[model samples]
Every structure is written in structure tokens, then in C-alpha cells.
Target chain A: MTAAYYAAVDWGTTSFRLWIIAEDGTVLAERRSGEGMTTAAKTGFPAVLEAHLAAVAAPAHLPVIICGMAGAKQGWVEAGYLDTPAALSTIAAGAVAVPDVDRDIRILPGLAQRDLQHPDVMRGEETQLLGAAGNLGDGRHLVCMPGTHSKWVRLEGGKVTGFSTFMTGELFDVISKHSILSHSVADAQVFSGEHPAFLAAVAAACANPALATNLMFGVRAGQLLHGATATDAKATLSGTLIGLEIAGALAAAGAVDSVCLVASGSLGALYRAALASLDLSPRIVDADEAVRAGLSTAAQAIWPL
Target chain B: MTAAYYAAVDWGTTSFRLWIIAEDGTVLAERRSGEGMTTAAKTGFPAVLEAHLAAVAAPAHLPVIICGMAGAKQGWVEAGYLDTPAALSTIAAGAVAVPDVDRDIRILPGLAQRDLQHPDVMRGEETQLLGAAGNLGDGRHLVCMPGTHSKWVRLEGGKVTGFSTFMTGELFDVISKHSILSHSVADAQVFSGEHPAFLAAVAAACANPALATNLMFGVRAGQLLHGATATDAKATLSGTLIGLEIAGALAAAGAVDSVCLVASGSLGALYRAALASLDLSPRIVDADEAVRAGLSTAAQAIWPL
Candidate 1:
């Protein structure tokens, strides 16, 4: 069997994943845990990484390439950002090395849109973009990466012209748990993309994004006046947020020929359905694979086998 | 002072106000407390009302006219709703008397827009509308009542055409408290409508209401990348929500001659400033006075002396 070449880690705010890859680019071992940057920050980033590395039985000298919050200012090491307009290939050049470590460890820098008006910053998603860029090829593509903070990137050729982050997932969470709509969706049964309420909300919000909050309120009113089920309320809330996101993204990236959605699991499915509902079939890219591929690309660039 | 003739009360979701009126229709004594429907629901609504009434030194036989959440199905009595296109004068006639109560207490009905597409209900704000209608007269007036759940009413010839509720204030609260933006506005100083950040955000949101959530995210991004102040973050958040609400309200109302702002205190000042930023000078009305006037209007109609 080929020896492990390097370890790739996606250290997020609340999740940690590690992959031991062979020189042949095959994943030899894998590990995942909830001890992400948040936990690692408290329990020492090195210790947490070492524990995960040990769990994967990675070679002692196996170099590691890390992305996401581990590179944030509040993460393991402060890996600064690359200001846009930036080339996806240049991300490897901005990777920051951890000081005084036995094994070589590098954390990829984030992207910063320093436009005084917009002034957006992204940590982990840049890596995903780097990986997804291959699938997107050299064209003007609107890439939607759905997550806690859903990012919509405008990529021209291999360069990221601009991007916008919608607080979709986070807003959904806070709204459901903290807002008055909480009562409307309490103990809601699991719903899917095909939900009537969800589809209708997506259509309504995409049509009139101005009425996003009003539509959110309708979740409660619908339950009260229309006897809308808990699931209906939940679906409506989800669709409203997702729909507003799509509208804003479309508005920002005017007349895009293709949309690349880099997402995983249920979230990806949801976004795909929403996009389809809006008469757009986005090019699907598995986010998990994209991040791993991105980390591998960075690792190969830094330590070519 | 003349003996107390009737007690006018505005019982809301989180607040309660009582005004003892004399035979001359003058406020002889007044009481205000946080014993709103929420508190009353847990601690007996009748007891809470009696405590406030007794504090105001109202006569036992004095009739009481109440409005707002006290008339909700979950409140002291189910006063029900007056469906649209409802005449402002019809609100008093639909008042539901508190069954088996010592006093002749009647809680005024709220307004319900039962359109299946946009089902909406308002309690206390309906009373405010009832009073504000007298001042507005026969016209196409867009009434913007800014609060936790801001109600934008469309009145055509003293009859309610329709209305929309923007969850502006509640969203601000939940987003500021529970979302990542919480860090951006942790110790924010009190800011008003004149704030440059506030004005800019208001302008941005109004112009591009579709980008409401994105604008909301900018509060955090601005802080992280542009070193935006806490006050700036807070003001920006305030402006974004209010501006989006205004945009939605205007879009829903369509071609109104004038905008009527019925609000109180700093919130009123804030809305006025937000409206002015968009070149809209809304005719202002005190929310407190409007509710009182609405209750008085209902009182006179229910039990004409």
C-alpha cells in the first residue's frame, strides 16, 4: 500500500474533519468530530489536531493542510486574507505556516472583498471555491454555497470578481428558536423540498423579496387563521429565507448563464429544489468532496509528491 | 374633577395602560404597567386588570372599555375580529363583553385581513387605527404603525382596504441577541435616525429590499473588515429592518397620497428619520394618544352617556 503523503483538515467553527491521503491521491484514512475551532480553541488546537491525527493513525511526519476557521484570526493561527479580485490559484500562495511545529502544517488564508461599501470576508468557503473552480471551468458562474452563512460567488474565468453572504441558515435557526415564529413552528414534523408551503413561499419571496419579513410573519398568522400545521409553518419559514437568498443572489449576479451549487446532503437538496423552483438548474458539486479536493489542491501545491 | 365615568384600557401583548375618564371625557387618572397579556395569561387576566384599575382608583360600577390582546382568544375574553373591508366605526359594535364580570367591561374587536393569500390579524393597532381614522378622514392613506410587529394599513375613505405586518422590531431583537451580529453590536451606544450609518443603511435597504438579509450581514462584515463602531452596527441594523419594512409597505400599498406614522418615543423619531431619508415626510401621530382616543371612541359607542 502507498504510504500516507499528507493529511488534509477542514477545521470549521463547530466541526472538524481530517483525511490521510496517499501519494496516489487516494484517501487512506478519515476522521471527523465536533471538536472544531471552537472546541480546539478552548482545548488547544495542536492537541486537538494531534488527537485526530492519532485517531487516524497518520504517520508522525505526515504534513497537514488546514482550511476554514483554523485560519481565522480567532482560530488556531491568524492566517490573513487575500484581497479580491483574487485568483483561485493564488490561495495556496497565501497559506500561513504554523510556527515551531515538528510536522509542517499550513492554514489557507481567507478571501476579503475590501470594497468599502460591501466589505465582505469569508474564511472556509474560499477553499471550497478553489476546488469547485475546476468543475466550473473558465466562465462567468454564480456559485451558491449553502450553509450557516450561505455564500454566493461571482466567478469570471478563474478569478472571483465578488461574492455576497446571506445569513440564511443562521437566520433560520435564530428565527425558529428566538423569534415569535418559534411558536408557529414548534415541534414541527420533518418537511422536504416538495412541501407546498415551502414551494409557495419560495415563489412569493423570489417574486417580492421586499416582503421577506412580512412573509415570515405569515407563518404565525397562517397557523392562527388558516390552521397551518407546524410543518407548514416550518416549511414556509425555510422557503422564505431560501427564496430571499436566491432573489438577492440573482439580483447581484445579473444574467448568469450557469449557477454552481456547492453544498452537501439535505441542504444541497433543499437549495437544488429551490433553484429548480425558480427555473434554474444549478451545476451540483458535493461540498464535502469540494472542500477535500480544495485541501488536496493546496497540499499538492505546497508539498508536491 | 368629575367622577370617573368610564375606564379606557389598552391591553397589549407585553404592556397595559388604563385611563379613568370623567363625565367630561377628560382623563381623571391613568395607570401603566408591564402586566400585558403575556403576564396576565399566567397570573389571571382579571386579577391583573383589577389591580391596575384599583391603582387608578376607578369606581367599582364604572364601565371599562378595553382593546388589544385582552380581546385575543388567549386573552381575558375572545373579542374576535372584524374582517376587512371593515369600516373603522364597526370596531366598537363588535366589542365582546367580559362574561360574568362585576363591571360592564367590553373589549373591542381587532381587524383581520382574511385574504387566503395574505392572512393577517391586529389587535391594539386596530384601536389606534380607529382613532387615527378620525384625523385621517376620507383619503387613500398609508398608515405606518412602527412597533415590535409594525403594521402598515391601507385606508381608503375611512374603510380598511388591507394591511401588512412587517416583523421588523422582533427580527432586530432576535438577530441582535441570538445571531452572530450579536458580537458586532454587543455594547452598542444608543443611536438615532440622524446617524450617517443609519441613513446609509436605510437608503441601501430601501433601494434594494431584495438584499435585506445581505444588508443585515453587512453589520457584522462592516465591523470585522471596516472597523465599524458598535453604534454604527446597531444603527445599521435598525436602518436595514426599518428600510426594508418601508419598502415592503410601500410596495404593498401602491400609490398613496400621504404616509401616516403612528408611533411613540424614540421609535417614532427613528421611523420619522427613516421615512425622511427616503424623501417621505410622513404625517406623525402619537401612538399612545391614538390608542387612548381609539378606546374612548369605542367606549362612547358601546355605552353612550
Candidate 2:
């Protein structure tokens, strides 16, 4: 049997996932928790990591590799950022080692596009991009990593030319819970990507990207005037924001040889359906596998097996 | 002293303003309070209005003419809506008198555009439109009533052809308080409409309204990369939303012979500057005077002196 190797971790703002991988790239153990950067910041990152490691019975000296907000300025250690027009391979090379540890530990730096007209930054998603890029062929590719902040990357050859971050997920969340539209979508049930209201809203928002707020208001107006259901209203809000993000993403990219969606679960399915409606078929990549692959890549480079 | 002929009230969602008018339409007394429809709904609209009426020494028999949320289904009484392209003059005639009240009291009906493509509803702004439209010379006029839900009415020959409601103000409020960007703008100070950040953001949003969420994210990126101030972040948020609104309003209205802005106070100044930056010098009409004029128009029609 292959010996247990390094531990790979994806530590987001509010989530933490760990995978103990064998030297042969097999997962020996896995753990997930709500103790992300925010929680770990107060509870202590070293203790949090030890507790999760102990649960999985991992080696005491097992090397660890982390990405995401763990490298944010306010997180464990500020790993900093790599300027745009950066190569994917350089991602692993930019890993910053955490000091005074029993075993080797490193956090990957994020990517930044400092253009005066269009500035943007991404921490964990860059690692996802690094792993997802290997799945894509050469030439120009539009890589979309959707989350609380959806990132649309302009990748050419093997380099990240630039990227844009759309607050689609966050906007949907705030609007659904805090805005006047909250009343309209409060009792919303689970709605699929194929829901008519969702499809229609996606199309309407893309049709007139400028009328986003107007279309959002239509969610409430539709309920009032046409008796649209709470589920439908929720779907509409989600669809409208997603559509606007797609419209802007596509518009900014101009033309791409292929579009790659690096997302997992429900969001992935939703984006696939939305992309299909817009006459584009994206090459789908699982976010979980991609992040793990990314961590493995950095692990291999740091501690050549 | 001129005797009070009728009391005109503009009861909004979160505010209430009243004026005692004489037989010759002279202002006999005025009252303002936070007792809007939301507060009055729970505390009793009649009691709220009676207290204000008594404070102004209003005569026992003085009829009240109200226009706003007081007429909503959830307010004092349901005044319903006048379907479009309804004449502005019909708004006064559509007033629903309060049943069982000793004195004659009526609430004006709101305007509703029932078009399947652009369904919209406006409660109090119809009265403002009725007042502001009179300021226009004729042909075609685009009336902008900025508020929580800014309404842009298309008026042609004194008729409200159609309108669109943008959730601009409310979006600003929710996003400022509920999103990740909230941290970036939490310590923001008062920024004038003339702030460079405001102008730059307005230009950028108008240039690519499709990229609104992206541009909004730029506020944080700008701060991270360029050390932008909290005031600039706040201004950017305001300008971006306003710019997107103006872009959509213009696109929806098409070509109009004249543009009129019916707003008061600081919001009015902000919109004016935003419009001016876009090379639009809209004819200004005070919102306070407009609502009073609208109530008086309905009052004169209901209670002829």
C-alpha cells in the first residue's frame, strides 16, 4: 500500500475541506467542517488543523497545503498575489510557507488584475483555475468559477490574461433576505434550473442587461399582477443575476474557442442550463476535484516525491 | 386668517406630509412626521391622520385628500389602480372615499401598467406625475420620480402611456448593509455628487451597464490595489446604481421631447448631478410641491369651493 503523503485543504471564508492523500494520489482520509478562515481566525488555525487531522488519524508530521481565504490578508498568513498575465504553473511556485511549524505547510497566493479600468482579485479560485486549466486544450478559453463571487477568467494558451468578479451569488442572497423583494420570495421552495420563471428571467435579463433592477422589480410585480409563486420569484431573482453575469462575462470575453465551467453541484447544473439556453456548451469541471488536484500539484512541487 | 378648506396628505411607505389648504388654494398649515403607511398601518391610519389634523387646528369638517401608500391594499383603504394608457386627469376621479367616516376623506388611485412585458405599479408617484407632467410643454415627456423604487413614467399628451420601476434606492440600501462590500464602505463619510469617484463610476457604469456587478466589485478592488477611501467606495456604490438606472430608463423611454425630474432634498441633488453628467439637463420640479399640487387637483375636483 502507498504511504500517506501530504494533506490538501481548501479553506474558504466559511467552509473547510481536507483530504489526506497517499503518495500515489489516492485519498486516504477526508474531513469537512464549518471552521473556515473566519472561524479559524479566532479558534486558532493550528488547533483547528490539528483537531481535523486527529479525527482522520493522520500522521503528526504530515505536510499540509492550503488555498483560499487562509491566505487572505486577514487570515493565517498573507501569501500575497500574483499579477495578471500569470501562468498557471507559477501558482504552485508562488506558495508561501507558514513559519514555526512541526511539518512543512504552505498557502498559495491569489491572482490580481490591477488594470485602472477593470481591477479584480481572486484567492482560492486561482488554484481552481490552475487545476481546471489542465482539462482545457490550448488557445483562448473563458473559465467561469461561480461562488459567492463568480469569477470569469480570460485565459489564453496557459496564462490567465485577466478576470472579472460578479457579485451574483451575494446579490441574490442579500436581495432574497434583506430587500423588499424578500417578501415576494420568502416562502420559496427548491426550484430547478429548468423552471419556466428561471428560464424566462435569464432570457429577459440577457435581452436587456441594462434593465437588471427593472427585471428584479418585475419579480415582485409579477407576483402582484400575475400571481407568480414564491418559488418562481426566487428562481427569477437567481436567474436574472446569473444571466446578467453571463451577459457581461461573454461581452467582456468577446470570443472564445471554448468556455469552461469550474463549479460543483446545483450551481454547476444551473450554469450548464443557462449556457445551453444561450447556445453555448461549456466544458464542465468539478470544483471539489479541481481544488484537490490543485493542492496535490502544489504538494508535489513543494515536496518532490 | 384664511379658513382651511381641505387637508392634502402625501402618505408614503416610510414618511407622511400634510398641508392645510384654504379656499383659494393657499397653504393654511403644514405637518410632517415619520407616521407613514408602515407605521400608520399598525397604529391606525385614521388616528395618525386625526392627530396631525388636530395639531394644525384643522376644522372638524375639513375634507382630506390623500395620495400615496395610504391608498394601497395594505393601507387605510384599497383605492385599486387605473390601468394605462390612462389619462393623468382620471387619477383624481378614481379616488376612493373612506367609508363610514363622518367627514369626506378620499385616497387617490395609483397607476398600473398592465403590459405583460413590462408590468409595473406605482402608488404615490402617480400623483407626483400628475403634478410634474403639467410642467412639461406637451408632445412627449419622460417623468423621473426617484425614491426607494424609482418610477420612470412615459407621459404623452397628458396620458401615462407606460412606465418602469427600478429598485435602485432599495438595492443601494440592502447591498450597503448586507454584502461583503459593506466592510469596504462601512466607515464612508458624506460624498458629494461631484466627487471624482462618483463621476468616474457613473461614466463606467453607463459605458457598460451590463458590467454593473463587476464594476461594483471594482470598488473593493480599487481600495485593495489603490487604497481608495471609504467615501469613494460609498460614492462609487451610489453612482454605479444611479448610472445603471439612468441607462435603463433612457433605453426604455426611447426618445422623449422633454425630461422632468420630480424629487426633493439631497436625493434630488444627486439625481440632478447624475443627469447633468450624462448631458441631460432635466426640468426640475419639487416633489413636495408636486404631491401637494396633485392632492389639490383631486381636492378641487372632489370638493368644489
Candidate 3:
């Protein structure tokens, strides 16, 4: 398959990314923009696509694959998700093609939990799973994807068996900025995850797991009573929230011998550190790389010429 | 003591209040400005006093008493609190008199918990406690002050037995605006605490008071599974958090035979309502009225001409 150009789009709530790649998956050009699903209501889907395309010197007929919250209800088009125990073939078949795109475009359907009493959905992480499958050679592995809406997925032989979502990042931001914890957290200490107090906090949350509420109060009480620094309290709040998420996710996913972490950004590293504390040192992989490999897989499945 | 003039000031962190009162504590003339402790850096103590005094029609030697966050560290001057089990005398002794004013000005000292291993401080609420004491009579009662920082104070015979602060409102705002709960909450359904869903949520939180983190996940899960409305979920999250706080506060304050709740806003009323489900029927009193009555008590204490 000697493809002249390949394009992969990682579009989510906050941002959009377009990668112009060769057949070998080496990037030829890349474009990033502020036009994501969150801003898509104002920017419109066609405009978002056009803006990214305009930034890169790519052919009009380049085969394109997209992932992430771009397939959410508020995204460009609602490209639905495959239920748990999903097959790669079924996922590929479920891809919702954009009606009027110039090139061969396949939007990767996300993974969802439909077998349960109530259905939970995802949109873009399936691409990441495919990317992990391509790299890890298809086996039962615990995949941890950490973000604002962190996903813990179980992948077996290139198919997603089950997954759980943690509101870790969102909780961290809220507790630190809006709760009693905020009293001890200044905005300047937003990235203070490495502080010793932070690790102590993480350990505390992971210890009781049920004391998440008390843990938050402890931040304020620690400062008021124990003279814990505002910075330390802030870090503790962050660590506790993340630690709780880790415990919750692990419980939901059941125990696994090995953990394969699909992580991105500094926050993901924080999660990796948290998982490590819980005796689960994950095989870390960058989300960007995974999504790129995922696009490659999806591209191969569609235009295998 | 035939008083020609009277003055009452409700000074807080972010704002200052001055009221030219009658002998009966009727606010004949009142003025409020943004000269709170937050903006006090730009405007000094002298400036704050001058700005509000300038609103008066005449300069008389009227006795004035103030309360609230103005006694905080960054206020005009730190009006330190009286240690409990203390009474009006304790607070009066600590009152800091402001000089160079044409009138007798006394800043009321707030309440501080020095008995506990970890001290808890509260400004302005002491005056409210005085008012509540007057209204409820000298007996054991619980007061729930709801705001960004909600305080549940235990009082017995005009003395504050103990208190605990919960960041319920702030947490609600943060989770509803920043967390996954944000998705399940609409901007419109924030304050309708009487919603059936809100009561159900209160019950759910009360059921496992310790499982707040897991219970929060239930908001998103409930929405996904049961077609729960965003407003309902939002209210549920709010109820759950508040309910947890109630349970925690009740435990911390020790068991009570009866509860007479002194609450101010609709939010406070909602908290009272939530507590009611636990068979704790609280006799709700308006917080603002409590403050007014409390201010009158303070004025009487300072003047006593």
C-alpha cells in the first residue's frame, strides 16, 4: 500500500489536530486549531475541517480518519460507538462516513458499555485502542487512558471487552477551585502534583478510598489545625481526588496482572504515578502516538489498495 | 437614655454596611459599598470609614458596632475572636475601637474555637448567634449558615458548643460547572431544592453518606441509564453533597434530641429540608433577620447608655 498521503484527525472538546502522514506513518505535515467540539457549535463542522485543511498542504483526496469527542452529540456528526466486547470488524463497520467530505473519510466509532442496565458511551478512544492493539499485538491487557474524562479499558485481541470512566481531572479542578479545598489552593499551584504532601494525600485517598469527602475536608483542616501549607493542601486535594479515581477504576475493571496505560499530557503522567502507588505500574504510551497508529489501522481497513 | 441618633454597621470581607438607626434599631438611613476586605487593599481603614460616614446627613456621637469578615486578617484591623465557652462580655472585651471618628465606633469580635485541638475561626456569625439566642431563647439549638462556606454551629445557652464548616455550595458549583456532573446539570436547575429529584438525591446521599465519590458517579450513571434529566441530576448532586455534610455535621456535633435551625437563604432552607428527611425537623429562622437582631444586640452591648 504505497499511499501518497494519509491524514489523521484527533478532534475533541477543547482542540483539533490534523496530521498529514505518508504510508509509513511518518508525519509530513501537521495542523492544530482551537476549533474543537466545544467550539464547534460556533465554528461549524465544515469550517473546522476547512480551517485545519487550509493549514496543511495536503491533497484534496487524502484518506482521512478522525477520533475523539468529534463524534459526540455536540460534535461535527454523531458517529456512534460500539458496545463492550466489541470486535474491530464491527467497529470498522460502524464508522459513520461524513456525507460530503472531499476525501475518503472514516470516523472511528468509540467504545461504549451497553450490556449493563444503563448504557454509557464513548466516541474517540476506540481509535486509541486500535492503536494500542496494533502496537501491543492483541492480548488481554488493562488499558488506562487518563484525561479530564479518564477511561480504563480492557482490550483483548484487538477488541475492547469493557471500560470505566473516571471524572478525576474534572473533580481535581472543581475541588481545588471551588470546594473548601480551594481555600488552601491558589491558582499558581495548579501543577503541584510532585510535592511530598501530594504523595501523602494520594496514599491517604488510596488507603480508605471511601474517605474522599473527609479527605477533602482534611485539606482545609490540615492547614487550619496542622499548619499544612496552602500549596501542600492544594497538592493533597489533587492527589486525593486522583487516588480515589484510581481505586474506583481498579475496582470497576477488576484485578489485572499487567496494566497498559494509554496516557497523554502531564495529567496522564500524574495518573501513571498514582497507578504505580497502587502497585500497578502501567506500560505507558502517548495518546498522540496511539491515535496516529489507530488511524493507520483504520486507513488500512478501509483503503487497503 | 433618650438617643437622638443610632448607627449599625454590618462590615464583611467584600463589603461594608452603615446604617443610621433609631433607638428601636430601625435602619432610618442605610448605605452599603464595595469597601469589603477583598477590595480593602486599595482602600484603607480610614477610607472605608470615611466613605460610609460621608453618606450620613449629620455627624453625631452615635455609638456604632460592626460585625462580619471585616474582622479577618486583611480587614481594617484584625478584631480577634473571644475563646469559648464565652458570652457577650468576652466578645465586648476584645472589641477594637477605631479612633479619630466623630462617633463611638466599636468593631465586634467574631467567634473562634480555641478549645479544640485545631481551632476554627468565624467572623460575623457571632452576632448572628446572639440574634439566634435571642430568638430561640437560652437552650441547645443547631444553626446552619449556608454560603460558599456552610457552617453548622451547635449552641447551648447562648454559647457556641462547637461547629463544623462544609464547602457544600462551593463544591456544588464546582462539580456542576467543572466535573462530569457538569454534563448532567443545566444552568437553569441550580436552586430549585424542592425538586423531587433533589429530595431523592438527599435520600441517596444520606443512605451511604460515606460513598459521595461513588454516589457522584451515580449522577452520570443514573442519567445514562434512567434518562435522568440534567436538572434532576444537578439537583441530586447538590442534595447529595449537602446531605453528606449534614450527616457528617450531625455526627461531629454529637447526637441531638431536637434541632432548631437558624438559616438565611433558600440554600439554607434547602439544607434544613434535607436534614428533615433524616427525621431532624429543624425550625428554620431567617439568617438576615438573625444578623439584624444580632447587630441590635451588639449595639446594645456597646452603647448601654
Q: Each model: TM-score of chain B? A: 0.98, 0.98, 0.88
Please provide, for model 3 over B129-155, each residue's C-alpha lDDT reduced to its tens digit, 9 standing for 90 to 100: 777777666666777777666677888
Interface residue Cα RMSD of candidate 1 after superposition: 0.7
Candidate 2 lDDT score relative to the true structure: 0.91
User: Which docking band does candidate 3 fall into?
Assistant: incorrect
DockQ category of candidate 1: high
- Cα deviation of A97, candidate 1, in Å: 0.6
| Tens digits of lDDT, candidate 1, B115-139 | 8889898988999998888888777
Cα-based TM-score, every candidate: 0.99, 0.99, 0.78
Against the true structure, candidate 3 reaches a TM-score of 0.78
lDDT of 2 by residue, B133-166 (tens): 7778678889899989999989999999999999
DockQ values per model: 0.85, 0.82, 0.18
Residue clash pairs of candidate 1: none
State what share of the real interface contacts each candidate retains.
0.75, 0.66, 0.17
Better of 1 and 3 by TM-score: 1
iRMSD (1 decimal) for each model? 0.7, 0.7, 4.3
Candidate number with the higher lDDT (2 or 3): 2
